[model samples]
Target: MTASRTTSAPSVDRLAPWGFAAFVEANTHDTAYRPPVVDGPVGPTIVRGGRELVNFASISFLDLERHLPVRRYFAEGALAHGLSTSGSRMTQGICRPHHVLEQTIARHTGKERAISFATGLLANIGFVHAMSSAAHFDAGIEVRNRDTVFVVDRDVHWSIWKGLEGLGYGRNVHAFRHNDVTDLARILGRDRSRKTVVIAESLYSADGTMGPIVEILDACDRHGAISMIDDANGFMVYGPENRPYAREAAAIRERADFVMVSLSKAVGLEGGAIAGPAAAVDAFELLSGTSMFTAAIQPPTAYAAERTIDVLAGTPEIVDDYLAHAARLRRQMHEAGTPTLPTESYMLSVPIGNDAVALQMREWFVEDGYLVPVFSYPAVARNQALLRLFPHAGHTEEQLDGFLRTLATYRQRLGL
Candidate 1:
């Protein structure tokens, strides 16, 4: 009939435009999306349903929000500065505080310069696109399509994948096995001639595992690749001495490279930054989408971020408390037969194996006065779900005891 002469347009339903909705609905059943309201701070707590519960889901590891001085600074900054920047950085948004924050981060991280973005995702996306789009051709020598390879860790954050995808060079992208330096070496060896960019995170969110940054950086150097790491979760925890990335920042600058981190996590603020050589920072200024399109984060956020950095630098007690709490929590969970990711980081994940068990455990824990969520496939390993928790600096030993006791009760009920 079509061959004879009839022409028919495709139906809107045939396009499957709402496929994402159905997919989300089907996969989101076993995950509890709890939005607990924070009443006040008392060492890892939130007032839920008229009761204060031990909160193990907050990302403020250094207790920026709970710190009275920091809160006061933020409030005063908000009063002094307006709510929004109201214009893009390239236009009128580059204020004194934004530059101050950048300089503070640069000084703290031992980098030549630092460029800030509105959010973590924007920072990742902007970094990748900026590297790709910057004018590297100075002598009529065009950078070919497949000449630059984007080497990524298999378990990198989705925002990174989105950034590479947005670059539209899927075929040029290669993935190394997660934290497998051998495979990374193999991939880099294969592309010895091309300019490669190794993309990895300092600490993976899904498994709460640390990347072999020193090893990866060595591999990157061996293959003539640029080592670009996302230090979103590791920045505060791994200050200068403890972190390979931070310790190697000067060397990275010597070799002409960088690493990006989010201010929202341990910084307890709103934004991200790429710290490295001034050349790359200049390139970011010229080509980063966040710089070109989005307005800088509010002056108040910048002020808060700067203050957070000041606290991290000035006081070691906060970090010490956080580390001690994480160690105790891990020990308690392991003793309760709920093993966490193989690291000493504050982000803890208690594996439950089954989604139903995970959901039950999460709900039971929350009901029994512990606020932790069961992170599922999208956020972590599929089919191996776990209850994700964040023990902050404000958390006390008694709070830890309460959480452990509640988890023990739920573990008994579920026979876990």
Candidate 2:
């Protein structure tokens, strides 16, 4: 009846379709399930499919809602300020709270000054863009014959890479293996005759590994290069007595030259800042194209950051509780013999092998009453996936235990 139809499939539209149909055919299917929803950062959340799950994927390490002071400040201040900063710092946007927050950040991080941005990516990108603009001229002229080489960790964030790619600084960018100080040294030695600028993160977001700040600083000093450390993942998590960066900061005063950090992680707020020597800060403010073009950070977020710092610095109880919970969770994971990365802090990476296993584990755990994010290639190693769980101050011991039990169930069921 259909005339024995044997028609070739329609050739996919190359320009309009953009290969989305092909991609969907390959990656997506009707069987795929969606992640659940949450009421807030706290545990005992309501998922999308009418199920309740304990949330552990939140970056809200400090349960902000429990902090009455932070809530009160935001409530009263956000209303009075009426939300946005309305403009960039260079234009009509500069406000009193912005300056106050910058000062607070500078003092907290032991740097001369800080320039706040909307997000961490922007801060890192903006810093690189700004620094390159300022430093390029110096390299081309004053530095004399010496080339300007940009040294970056292989795993440096996409934003940092983007900044480098956009710059016209020749093909002098060097990539060193992740956290390999020796490789970095070898690269620097090759460029001993030129001026270099190093860019790296303090705490790697994916694996929870810290960069060797002390060694990197030493290398920068030897090579006569300016170093920029994105402390976005470190900041309040590490204090002077416990962490190397804090100790190094105290010793050298202005050792790293440029430091960038985000307020979103441990600070429990939304903003990023560049902290550095007063001169570098000045140079960034004056010459940075990003700073010149983009609107300054909103006043409310700046105020929120200021309040967050005060809360974190003043209340050791919160940090202590968070650390204790994390340690307990770590011990439980170890006992369960789950393949979690060795971590000394709140960020925990539960390695789940390949993408399929990671996705299966995430789905199965959600069904058993827990929420953990599954991250795969392009963010981490190809085929190497993980369930990144962040322990927050708000979750109780019982809740954490529930999460562990659910994880164990999934771990066994999936034969992980």
Candidate with top TM-score is 2
TM-scores for all predictions:
0.85, 0.85
**Each candidate: what lDDT?**
0.75, 0.73
Residue 84 lDDT in candidate 1: 78
Residues 1-416 of candidate 1 have per-residue lDDT tens digits of: 45687878978577577685466566554434434455655446778657877777777667765554777777777888877778777666477778898999887766899998888888888888777764555787333333567989999988888878845454568899999999999888777446679998877888787787778888987788887888888776675454334543333334436778788788777898888888779768767777778777788888878888888778766766667767777888888777677776667877778876877677677667777867776666677888778887777778777777777777787777
For candidate 2, what is the TM-score? 0.85
| Model 2 agreement with the true structure over 1-416: per-residue lDDT tens digits | 55786888666664445866665567652324332343433433535456666777667577766764666777666776757777666667467777888899888777888877778778887777665563335544321222457899998888788878845443567889999999999988888545579987877887877788788889898888888888777777776464434554443335777788888888877888888888767667656556767766666767777888877888777776777777778888999887678657567888887887787776677667776777777688888888888876777778877887778877787777
Off by over 4 Å in 2: 1-17, 29-51, 134-147, 168-170, 240-254
> Which regions of candidate 1 are displaced past 4 Å?
1-43, 48-52, 65-68, 134-146, 166-170, 240-256
Measured with C-alpha atoms, the lDDT of residue 346 in candidate 2 is 68
Model 1: what TM-score?
0.85
Candidate 2 C-alpha error for residue 181, in Å? 0.6
Task: Quote the positional error of residue 247 for candidate 1 in Å.
Answer: 7.3
Q: How many pairs in model 1 have backbone atoms within 3 A of each other, for residues 3 or more apart or on separate chains, i.e. clashes? A: 0
